[model samples]
Target: MPTSIRRRLAPLLLATATIVLAASACSSEPADDGGEQSSPSPSAEPTDEPTTDATDATDAAESGGVCATGDLSFTVTEKSQAGGYYLITASAEPGVTCTLEGRTVEAGFGSGVSGDVKPSEQAEGEPITMTGSIKAYAGVNPHSGPQEGGVQFEEIIVSAHEGDMDPVSLKLPGTAEVDQPIGTNWHTDAAKAVPFSS
Candidate 1:
């Protein structure tokens, strides 16, 4: 063969080999079926929900009526001249409130001065002090004065608010009562009613 023809044939052969190699490489490549690349599955995110406030939780636990059956410390500061009237100063839990009912007087005394005392407005905070007297009477009417023995603080209900308890009779001193789902009450032991200077 002629030297010039050999040169031309060599160039053609090189071009054909390059094309073959490229086709083979493309065929060997893996096919993607439009699928996403394999990756670690993302962890699920937590759901969002409103959480209870610490203050609200504490209030709920301590807001119920007084506990039934417990010892409560009470102090009688003043007693009426008629032996029936009494003035008392009592201390409750730091956040607890206290009040006294069933006392007799002309009117406008203690929390009940506004006729009927509601539960929400009883007593608030520690050391709730009330000045009033009890009267034992025959008729069920509260307006009437006590008849002979005088009506006891028949029911003393304390809660985060007033009028929250079942209204149990204040009988035993130092004994606490759970009249509602939460909270407790304390009764005093002092007998002689002393003068409350404050």
Candidate 2:
């Protein structure tokens, strides 16, 4: 070999080795040669849990719901005569809107009286809405039959349309008899509503 040829080949080989070393240093992958390697951090999508919109709660309130006992105020006053029957007025509290479905109300006489007064048979009727400044009432028959023992009730426990609520106790004007009493569906007109039937 000539000396000039050896010098030219040596420079070419050095340049190739430099290029190879630069590429190896710039590699973005982990080395598999038993050398320490950096690992990429785990990444995941961001979450938006534990947050709710205010409109959802408002929308639920606007939708019709069963009347809760806590939202009602009852009174025997404003009684409208429906022929020989009577209506017990029940007004809703402010900022409340609810419905009365099926047998909206049930009345039982006395404090501990469970089986004393019986609920009347009623046909399913359209739900009655009770809103702010609006009232609903149930029909009642003080005596639908003979007064066997002249049994009088001190107070009447009125249950609202809500099934999970406790019955509200309404004190009568005085101890009076309610024999085989019946009731009607809640309606806006107390005068025209008739007694409930099977």
Top TM-score hit: 2
Q: How accurate is candidate 2 locally (lDDT)?
A: 0.63
lDDT score of residue 93 within candidate 2: 82
At residue 137, give the lDDT of candidate 1. 15
TM per model?
A: 0.24, 0.59
Each prediction's total of clashing residue pairs, residues at least 3 apart in sequence or on different chains, is: 29, 0
Worst 10 contiguous positions by lDDT, candidate 2: 34-43
lDDT of 1 by residue, 1-198 (tens): 999999999989999999999988776663332232343334443436434575677766554434221212333222334322233334443443324322211111224433332221123223223223311110011222323332234333322224334322333233221111111122232332221211
lDDT, candidate 2, 20-57, per-residue tens: 98888767333553244333332343355422565677
TM-score of candidate 1 relative to the true fold? 0.24
